[model samples]
Target chain A: MYIPTYEDMLAAHERIKPHIRRTEVRTSAYLNELSGAQLFFKCENFQEPGAFKVRGASNAVFGLDDAQAAKGVATHSSGNHASCLSYAAMRRGIPCNVVMPRTAPQAKKDTVRRYGGVITECDPSTSSREATFAEVQAATGGDFVHPYNDPRVIAGQGTCSKEFMEQTDGLDMVVAPIGGGGMISGTCLTLATLAPECQVIAAEPEQADDAYRSFKAGHIIADDAPKTIADGLLVPLKDLTWHFVSGHVTEIYTASEAEIIDAMKIIWKHLRVVMEPSSAVPMACVLKNPEAFRGKRVGIVITGGNVDLDRLPWLAAS
Target chain B: MYIPTYEDMLAAHERIKPHIRRTEVRTSAYLNELSGAQLFFKCENFQEPGAFKVRGASNAVFGLDDAQAAKGVATHSSGNHASCLSYAAMRRGIPCNVVMPRTAPQAKKDTVRRYGGVITECDPSTSSREATFAEVQAATGGDFVHPYNDPRVIAGQGTCSKEFMEQTDGLDMVVAPIGGGGMISGTCLTLATLAPECQVIAAEPEQADDAYRSFKAGHIIADDAPKTIADGLLVPLKDLTWHFVSGHVTEIYTASEAEIIDAMKIIWKHLRVVMEPSSAVPMACVLKNPEAFRGKRVGIVITGGNVDLDRLPWLAAS
Candidate 1:
């Protein structure tokens, strides 16, 4: 297995600079008081596709050679990665295809279609998703972009922490929510070389704590299915992502489902940004373990803003 | 009635610079395509107090003489103005008193208290609010800062349009939600001097279309108690605000309750920002009158972000 270097991250930043948004770092005095720390939120939720996934998707799409580009790119994701990859492909005028679960939200499906991505629906199980994706990739002869495990994708995600470090000075720690470990792996890749003194922490929902358990066991632990309000963070860690997470992550924290929902409401009330449930886990972690973050300058990556408007977690019957 | 000059707006900007936020202007490709017009959103919902009311409230709180400053400031708003004024006064370490209807959302009442303002509850009636405010003023000897009917407040609100004009070039029209006409009046005051070529428009809920009626009649038409989902826009226009409204407004457009809710959902889904119902009116108007706004560059002011999270208008029983 090949490891992506800091040099690759630098090249990815240069390549994907104009294609993705340089999302601003936002702060809230109210949130500061609640957490007892000076917090800077790197608002990836403000990205064009409303997620940091755009960075990796754009990097992979733009790096393809003319011959490979003609065949386009293919991905199997039921979330932001699918729509974001589609958006990046559309920007370059290439044909893109997505294999999505039939149970995925209609809004998410519509977003992918709006970006001109052809969607092939599969059953809601993991085996079915992988089987369907294989068939589609074989038929289309397109470049396959794994959401988190690909070296190019990880290098692309590394640019987020690079920009965060440059956007603010003297960050004591950085926290991000982890699912498939894509964002956390990217943070580790950048921080390991650029600012080793700055701690990198990963947060996860307790209901879906495979990453936390994997960290404790010092090995990759796969969860076939995990139930949580944070739909984005249900996937277990892959080998490439686990390599970075196990080596560079300082700590892994977990928050309960109720606490995550409460944190989401607080962010909406104070920060005035619409964030999905998955994006609130890091804040919930910070709030729950104040001593770890107290009096520290903390940078939190707000992962995404794509949400089902009619079925907000707080509004849902729990 | 005395008019607030452009010079007064400049002075207010200078005085409130340290206290208020210079919110960024955001654009949406989806919204532009939907309306067939280039749209720029002035996101006042990102303000420190989560509303543009803080700009005016801060100006009023800071501009007081030493003697008046000792006495602090007072108001009778059941919405954003009350809490924003409290936040401004707390920043100055001055006394802030508010006379509010007891029936106002508990979240709003809590916000006022959180800012260290003393709340005086009154019956949910216009006469009761006015009468209770007079008694409180007499007892506290605080300077009364009428929410939208004061020159200082109007001048402070005018700075938003000035910043909008500087942020985005060549806006053909500026649209803002009108309640007591404070924001629309400020837009008129600034644009009438700085960008006379830009048409100024006001949007209101059809159920509480007092501003539209007053604009048509060439006189102020007071509504004692208008029922609308836009709680912040239920108040009638006053003499000072009407002066700017009658003289400078290009058009007053009204949207139905359903239309406002639809637009609010669209903004939350596409823009990924939490905006209150009143703030959604301008976008609703643009959607309803695409022909009036098509093929033009438009600026829309997002007024505030204060809402009862539990009782969203769309979730309310119809």
Candidate 2:
């Protein structure tokens, strides 16, 4: 339950420097002209494991003591985090145990295995996942690195913003999708100390607006089985994430499923980068509420690029 | 036809620097592991016009003297060149006239018009295109900038290699898709003068293997009509480009349509960058002839990113 400090983020950055990519920031003249804002896309999608989670995953893996590294790391995630953590552990020559829903896409499971991660499958329920993960961690004596809630993970994610600001002269606001708030919280953790003048904005799917509600209600509001095309953003805010979202996020903007899909297509069309629907949530929100962002320099975090090309959402029969 | 020299490329680089992006070189560890080569992808796709042609277009447009600039520029191509030239003309506040096939995709025509290019439609035949271009040029008094054959265009395209070399420590060889030979000739123009030890390899679709055959034959062998899924690489090499290809190119490789599509998908899946099928020819050739590139540092140009999301080739029903 530790609040990762600015110092922690700086240390995590140095520790994870060689393990993760300091991905390039891309700009589209067409998007800038369309949105009436100078936009810089931090393409964390270009990370070796195709996600910004690698930043945090590598930080946590590399920061572990030699004795603890020997014990290895474990996490339960069905998305980019699982593969990213496995990739980081492989780089460190340590064991990584991933607890994934048994019915999770085979492609995702294959990615985890490709990175040398051992999988413990669970029934597709939170209770089953927790129980399975607990058993695996107990059996392996592995460090349980909560995907976003762990202080080390948040600090690693915080370094993304530091690189973003360095990439651009400075951004008026930094926007990212909020699922468990790992990325947004990390952005807040860095900007609050590094560039206090910059606004931290969180974007979410309209269907899963728990973060927006929580921000308004002044408390954590967990959603049960919420669904959206932005599958990466279905999770609710945890305590560590809630702390930063409540304290530093200047706004939480939500976009409909249709809008998120449209943004994803537009980005692919113009930015020419394949990324997750969740990553487009920020662009979708900005486009919907243009007046707020016009004339401002906006940095959008394209969090991950893990996509099933065979069934691109845009190509699916509507 | 004038043969552009190394100094011409240097001047073109300076001329077009203000108008075009020094597009980044991206790498994929996954791709490197798959191909058994250290591959550097010079992402010309990230240019404002979404292709490498912008370099040539900007050079041609900006290199024009005030008197010639007032007359503006004209070209006849139904691909990226038309739109890129129009974009450059618009940047320079000059009129651009394009003679495109009337049957060209409405989307492409729309792109040219959006960039303020005036389109003069022609029948979809070489004779009709040349005649229509002549009439348009006569009526508008605009200078003709051949899509790839012009010395100015070749010189401008050569700047790509200058930047590519500067971006990487160095490369054993450079490979690019060769249709009209603008890009490959440019690479030869730069690398021959700058890094003679570096090889210049040309890649082409087997269906459009004129360049490969011509290189072997030691003379220009223009195809009457070559067709492939890589629409951008349909044109045959012109005499101006032939001079550089015959003089400096080390080897020319060809890939089947299936291989090209497979390479495009693999790159999209691993690099997470949306690029044209023609751009993937180099990777396709490399993968097919892995022994040639194994353990070597190779640079491949991802030439463009202009793709229709609704009609992605991979997603099309087989």
Candidate 3:
């Protein structure tokens, strides 16, 4: 198993600092009152690509040598990673190819295209995605950058926690929504070295709690398909991500679908930041486990702001 | 004639700096591409009270002497001003009384109460509001703070444009939505002294085109009851606001209700910020009049983020 060191994150920061925005850290007085915790929100939703995936994606794209970069970079994702990778590649003036499931939202597909990505559609299954991506790689001769399992990508995401430490003082606990364990693994990688005293917690949806089940079982347990409002957190943990999750993360908490939606609306109504359902899972954990967070200074990492405006979750029911 | 000097705005900035957030100026790549104008959005929607009115409201609340502050402050507004004034008073630990139209949305009324404002509902009419306000003042003995007509409030709004000048370089034009003209007057007050070369423009909804008509007629034209999606821009300009509007404003532009809603969706989709309909009129103007704004850098004041989430205009139509 390849373990990413703190120095890798430091180097990643130097490599991607100019390309990615050091998104603002904000506080919600109402949220603070509700949880009885001084909550500082790391707003990665404001990132140029509208997500924290840009950090990892940029690090991977820019770290490649000229000859390798000329061949271009490719990723297989149906979420923010596809657009973010494309955005990073565009910034570096490199070609980017994305293999997305045909079932992906048109908005997500449009975002990838807007960032100058060439998209190839595939069946929404793992075998089909792998086969389609392999064929595309053969045709384009592109470097394959895995969404979360790569050490370079993990190191790149570690840069976020570094900024969090610099932005706020003395965070007793840090929480992030676990979606294939990319963000949580990066948090584990950083907090382990810098502030081991600060507990690292992973939040997951109850309807799609593969990470929680894997954590409790003390091994990797892959779920074929789980349905949740948090579409981003449906993917199961990988080997490298599981390594960090098992060793460094202190706990994994889960929230119901109703709780997640309520938290999402609360952030919009009060904080007024346009974040997605995945971003609200961590907040849902904070609300559900109030005793664990009360009187503690907590940092919640807002993962992304990509949502379909027309089919908003609250409006669907109303 | 009570002309607000630039020095008063400087003073207001000093007094309210601790209380108000120095909102960030964000550039939208998509908005730039859509309008052919490099748009710099001053995001006052990020304010704690979800609006720019907090700046003026805080200035008024904090400017009061201890004896005057002891009696508290009062306003007759049905929108952001009511909640913002209450927020400012809450911060200063003083009483805030708001006489609002009973027809106002419950969400708006709830926001006022959340900030500890004592609400006295009246019939939806100028005469009824004024009459009810007088009775409330007699009962509570609160100092009446005019929403936009007061010199101190306009000076407070001026600080936003002052910050705008410092934040960006070489803006050829600055635009803001005009209602009672608090924000427009403030923009005029600051830019007239600081960047007189930069054209100051006001945008209004065609349905509620009192400001546009007032500009053409060279005097204040009060509208009895005009309906539009941009509800915050319904109020007509007062004498104090008219002074700055007639003298310093370069032009007044209007947009149809459809254009305003479209512009609002674009901001929410591309900018990923939760701003209200009133804030979208300026962007709509830039879109409709592309010839005037094309290739020029324009600063747009995003007035507020207070919206009734359940009753979204587009969702209503759907």
Candidate 4:
């Protein structure tokens, strides 16, 4: 139940500096005109590991003591977090064990292995994933780094906002896509202290709108299996992430699958950055509710850019 | 007879500062490992016009005197230059006349028109384009700005290299894809005075290796038409570009169609930048001749990102 402080975020930024990129902040006049908001995109897609997850992964891997580091880290992620944690561990000359569903894409598995992560397959169920990850951690004496629920990981993610705030002049509101709520939670934790005036907005895919429902219900709402084209955002928020989201976030918005893909195309066309569908959720929401963001300085986080080049959504739809 | 001077490039840089974007320089760790070169990418694809041609187009449009500007600027280009010149003219609140091939892609035509460019359609043949352009210029009393041949245009393109040198520590070589050789010539223009120790290398498609052949033959060899997936790199170099290429460029290399697409995929995968196939030639040649670039700092220019999202080359090939 550890709630990370501003000092923790400051420390995480320092700890992860050597291992992660301080990705660029980009602006598009076309997108600004379309949304009627001056949008500043914090391009975490430019991160070395192609996702902002590297920020948290680097912080976790680098913070461990030499003796603890020898045991390395373990996580249950079939997405960018697996690759990012593996990349961070590879950089530190340590082992990283990833517990993923056997049904996960082979491409995802290859990316983790490419970054020196050893994967153990589990049933595509939360209980099975937890069981497998626990076994892997017990056998290797590895530190368990939950994708969003952990204070260290949340603190690491907070550093993205720190950089985002520093890069732009000022933001009236900050927007980030919420899945497990790692990124959104981090945004809240940072702006709560750094720019308290700035409202934190969480965007979720309508198909996977557990966070949106939870915000209205005034409690943690876990979904069994929500589906969306933004595959990375199918997961539910955990206790630690819910703590930040429910308390600090001002509002939650959801976009349809079509809206997400359309927004992805616009960002790719105008911002000229290769980003994921999950990353498009914030922009999709902003475009959906233009009056909420119009004429204001809005900071949008482009969460990741790991997509199969051969399978562009727009190409498939057409 | 109007040869652009290093001082002209300096003046162009100053003049276009308020009009064009000072594009960011990007680096890819994966690309560095793949090519065995410390590669720095000058990302002109991120320009507002989605091409580096904007620099030269802006310089030409902005450098004109009130009388000349009032007459407005005109160009005969069916490529990035047309859209870029139109965008520059729109920025300056002036009329822009473009002489485009009637057979040009509707997307290109639509882009120019979107920016308030007045298009005069001409036959696809060179002679017809020229004749049509001449008539249009006479009708409008517009100042003709050749896409790459003009001294002002060359000087404006040179600003990209000026910023490249300032952004990176010191490149051992600067690489650019050669179609009409505006970008390569611009690199030569800036580096000849700024970093004379650095060599300017030109890359061309095997299908459209006119510049490669011209370099070896020690003369300009204009080709009527050549086909390549890198549609932007099919044009032949003119007298103005040939002047810089013959005087300052150290080597010319050609890459196959497959190689260009492969390099483009690699860039999209690793650099996470949406650039055109024309922009991939430098990296393709670097990979082809790794021995030459190995253990050296190489600067590769990503020329543009105005490709049709639905028609991704790799997707069509597969």
Candidate 5:
């Protein structure tokens, strides 16, 4: 399991500063009053490439040696990470080959193409993606940058928590949605080192509650297959991420599909910002479990804002 | 006709600095490449009350004397200004009476109530709204704050341009949607004084072209009733606003409903920000007449983001 030191997180911040946006924090009196918590939303929704993935992608690309970077980078993702990698690689004038599932949203695919990514579509199955990625890597000799299992990627994501801490002092708790656990692990590592008293919580969808079950059972749990509107959080927790989360994370909570949709609606109406269902999980958790967050100075990481307009959850009712 | 001096605009900026957001400026590479113009979008959509109206509303509330402010203020509108006034009044701990037309969206009415505004719903006809507002003002002795005709409101709106100029230097032109000419008039006044070389243009919907007609005829053009998806821009340009616009505004451009809808869709897809049809007029003008703006650094004020989700233009097909 890869563990990132505080120094590594600091270095990642400096490296990705120019490439990634220091997304502003959003606060609402209505939300604060309703939740009974002084909430600070770290709007990674506004980050470059429209997600927090940019931090990790930019760091991985820039952290490479001149010779290694010249060969370019590759990744497999059907979501924001693919676009982030493509955007980061485009910025550095390097080639990026993304192995995306054929079922990926057309909007996401178009965005990847716009960012100059070479898209290789494969079946939705993990085996197909891995097989196609290996073939591409072998042909091009490109560096395969793991989305979250990498120490460098985890360190890069930690910078978000670093910025959050600087923006607002003395957060009693920090909550983020857990997917492959890149963001939550990074968040925990940063808070544990810099603000030892701050508790880090992971919000997971009820349909994909591997992390929540793991936290309860005192073991690293894996969901062989998962389903949720939060497609970004469907991946099972990796060993490296689980190691950081198990030791440092205070708890993991779950939100229902209806709660996630409701949270998304609230964000759209109040914040006037679009967020994917995965990004709304933290808000959903807080809304559902208000007692745990009451009177706390809480920080919620809004992970991404790459929702497809055609597939908006609100449209389903119509 | 009351004209706001440049000093008034500067003072308004300082007074409302703490209350209103100095909204971020977003530049679109795709927009620039498509139009052959360097465009800077002054994102007033992200304002506290979800529109540029907050600047004017806050200024009106705070600029008043304590004794006068205690009496509170009143206005009649069916859109952004009503919500802005309510939000501003709530912040100042003053009573707010909004005489909204019965035709106003329930979302807007709910928002007004959420911000502690006393809502007095009236028929959409002029006689009914005026009578309702008169009764409210008579009963409460609150000052009648005209949506855009008052000097303080114009000065407050001018602050948007002041910030825009400071955020991006040497813009060749600035364009904003015209309703009662409040925004454009204020914007023109600021640019005329500070950046005299900059051309100020007004973008109005073809369906509600009172501002365009007024500019061409060199007289106030009154439309008893107008139809446009840009509900906020339905009102005819007022005499006070016409005076400022006629003297400082270089030109008035009109956009068709299709153009406005297209612009809104683009903003939703690329910018990930929701904009009402009124706010999209200026953007539509730029998109429709690219030749007029080629190679110029242009600033476009996105005036509001308070679109009713159920009535969003994109929902037509969905």
Candidate 6:
């Protein structure tokens, strides 16, 4: 298992700063009063390409030397990471090839194409995304940038927490949604170095709690299949990410699908920000377990705002 | 016609400081690049009661002396100002009686109820509204807070522009949506005193262009019955507000209904903020008349975020 050091995160920040948007920190007085916790929202929803995945993708794309960058980059993702990598690669004037599942949202594919990426779609159940990605990498001589397992990618995500800490001082705890664990690993590493006193917490959807189960068992646990409104958290925690999680993350909390939808509605009604289901996990966790975070200066990473407007979860009648 | 002095605006700022939220300023790199203007958005949409109307409503409620305050505050409004006054009066522990047209949106009426205001429904016609409001005022001895025509309200709104000037060093121009002209009057007064060199522009919907007509004709122009998606801007300019608008406001620009919808979509898609059609007016003005503001520093006042989510203008099929 590979684990990134604090220095790697700092290096990644330097490499990715020019390519990604330094999204602002937003605070809500209403949320603070509701939970009795002073909350700081690290708004990655406003990041370039509309998600925090850009930070990692930008770092991975730009980390290569000039000679290596000329060959381009390749990745397999059915969501934000694919579009992020494509956008980052396009900015560097390099070609990008993405192998996405046929079931991937049309909006995600459209974003990737808009950023000049060649897309190869495959069946989600039968086809090997990795093999397809490998074939593209071999054909184009492009570097493979894993969505979460890569150290450079983890370090890139760390920059978000770094900026979060700098924006507001004395954060007692930092909470983020855990998918394949790239964002949480990077966030944990950065806080461990800069603000050791701050506790790093992970929020996962109960229906897709592979990371939560893994943390409790003290081993990497893989779920055969999972279902949750937070599709971003459907992936199991990888070994490389598990190493960082075991060492630095304090605890993992889970939220029900209903709670996630409630959080989304609250954000829209009060904050006037359109946050996707994945980004609502942290807030849902806070609502479900207010005792753990009450009266604490908590920082929640609002991961993204890329929900399809035509199919908004809140608008759906149960 | 009477105009407020700079000192009057400053006094209003001090009086309403405790009651209203000092809304934050947001700058978008994407908007800057697209508009060819360095834009700073003063987020009044995040203000208490979710609009800049709180500043004026709070000032009006708190400005009353003990005897007058005991009588409480009353207003006839179908939108943000009604809710603002209702909430403001609730905070002061005074009774608020709002006379709203029966045709007012249910979402807005719900907000008024949430703030503990007593609502009196009247016909949509002006004669009925005036008659009902006068009867209510006479019966309860409640002090009437004219939506945008009062001196105190204009002074209260001035504080927003004052804060904008303090937040960003220099501004080439200040743009605001003009409904009944209170916000623009306040903005113009603040800039004229502190940033005399800066241009103050009013943005109005072409469908409700009474302010634009008045600015052009050099006299008050009334729109007896106007129709626009920006419901907040349906009122005609008042005597006191018109005095300030005529003297200090540099120019007036109008945007078509389609343009306002486009601006609203842009903000929702890129910024993830739910700006009402009225709030989008200034942004639409910039988009419509790019040459007037290109390569310059612009300050846009996002006046409110009080929109009926169930019936957002853009959501309706064209």
lDDT agreement of model 2 with the native: 0.94
Scored against the true structure, residue A158 in model 5 reaches a CA lDDT of 96
**Tens-place lDDT digits, model 4, residues A28-76:** 8888999999999999999988999999888899999999899999999
Instruction: Write the candidate numbers in order of decreasing DockQ.
Output: 2, 4, 1, 3, 5, 6
What TM-score does chain B of candidate 1 reach? Answer: 0.98
In angstroms, how far off is A200's CA in candidate 4? 0.6
* Deviation of model 2 at B312, angstroms: 1.6
Cα lDDT of model 3 by residue, A86-128, tens digit? 9999999999999999999898999999999999999988899
Chain A (alone) TM-scores for all candidate structures? 0.98, 0.99, 0.99, 0.98, 0.97, 0.97
TM-score of each: 0.98, 0.99, 0.98, 0.99, 0.96, 0.91
Query: Between 3 and 6, whose DockQ is larger?
Result: 3
lDDT (tens digit, per residue) of candidate 5 on A1-318: 558888999999999898888887878777888899999988887775788999989999889888888888999988888899999999889989989889988888998999999999899887998899999888777788888998989999999999999999769999999989999989987988999899999999999999998889888788867889999998888888988888999888999999999898887777777778899999999999999999999999999988877667766877
lDDT of 1: 0.92
Candidate 6: tens digits of C-alpha lDDT, residues A145-217: 8899999899999999999988897699999999999999998889888999999999999999888888999
True A-B contacts kept by model 6: 0.40
Which residue segments of model 2 deviate by more than 4 Å?
Answer: none
Instruction: Give lDDT tens digits, candidate 1, residues A155-207.
Output: 99999999999999859999999999999999999999999999999999999
The interface root-mean-square deviations, each candidate in sequence, come to 1.0, 0.8, 1.1, 0.8, 1.8, 2.1
Residue-wise lDDT of candidate 2 within A67-181, one digit each (tens)?
9999999999999999999999999999999999999999999999999999999999889999998899999999988889989999999999999999899999999999999
Ten contiguous residues minimizing lDDT sum, candidate 6 chain A: A309-318
Interface RMSD of 5: 1.8
Checking candidate 2 for backbone clashes, the offending pairs are none
Model 5, residue B285: distance off in Å is 1.5
Clashing residue pairs, backbone N/CA/C < 3 A, model 1: none
Stretch of 10 with least lDDT, candidate 5 chain B: B309-318
> Candidate 4 — which pairs collide?
none
| Tens-place lDDT digits, model 6, residues B160-234 | 999998989879999999999999989888888899999999999999999999999999989968899998999
- Each candidate's DockQ: 0.75, 0.88, 0.71, 0.87, 0.51, 0.48
